[model samples]
Target: MSKFKKKTGTSQDIPTSALPDIIFMLLFFFMVTTVLRETDLLVEQKIPAATQLQKLEKKSLVSYLYIGKPKNAALYGTEPRIQANDAIISVDDIFRWVTEEKDKLSEIERDQITISLKVDQEVKMGPITDVQMELREANARKVLYASIKKVDL
Candidate 1:
């Protein structure tokens, strides 16, 4: 053998100069693709668990209606309330709200709009029924009841 030693198969150190860039790209991708919770839940609306659940294919066609008791009894009182967006709304307001929401979309897409009901499990059916009637009057027939998927331990 000559003075030079034989080379052994060994892994070379990976160049980490672009590691930060790769990490930044991954971070940016997750930030862009993550589905942020659309609504700030002001009420105590713990959705009831269910066996079967279906995901809304198109998020744009969905409008959320929150029905539950106010978080602070001192401020909003102890009674249950219907929240359309940021404010607590009366039952009659549903019709106008639905109409306005529908108008935002194209006329052809109006019929495809789904009113998602996020009602509290602890609340009674009276308020829910009232909301349903209001939706019916508003002609927003596609109503979806939002619920948590039940997991059997």
Candidate 2:
């Protein structure tokens, strides 16, 4: 009875090192379960939102722009839509590119295609508007800005 009583009272079965492991595991589990915010762009800008907005249907023509610490022009163009938010392309270059592409296409084809610019939310009106003017000069019927979702020409 004494042996059994002593065995019950002084239990040496449990490992002392396991306490930290269990605590660490629990902490890790909670930390892993916590949600983290994601980064969508280089610079954070508070863009004005609409009350009721329609989602963009065509991802094909979608372009992206990032406003970083130093450079403001960061464009990403892909197939069917050239993404050029990286190095800033001036109005002259824009005009040249559009005109060159326009010269290749027929009048009918021109009507089918439209140029859309995705600018950083913080990017000023000067450049954005300049691109718009350039597009118009190049004879691009419909010019657009990505963040705005509408042309501000």
Candidate with top lDDT is 1
TM of each candidate vs. truth: 0.80, 0.42
- lDDT assessment of candidate 2: 0.51
TM-score of 1: 0.80
User: Would you list the clashing residue pairs of candidate 2?
Assistant: 74-85, 75-84, 75-85, 75-86, 76-83, 77-82, 77-83
- Residues 35-122 of candidate 1 have per-residue lDDT tens digits of 9876777789899999998888998999999999999788889778899877788899999999999999999899999999999999
On TM-score, the leading prediction is 1
Candidate 2 accuracy as TM-score: 0.42
Question: What is the per-residue lDDT of model 2 for residues 28-110, given as tens digits with 9 covering 90 to 100?
Answer: 99999997643234333444433444556654333333322232234423211122433434456776766655556666665
Off by over 4 Å in 1: 1-14
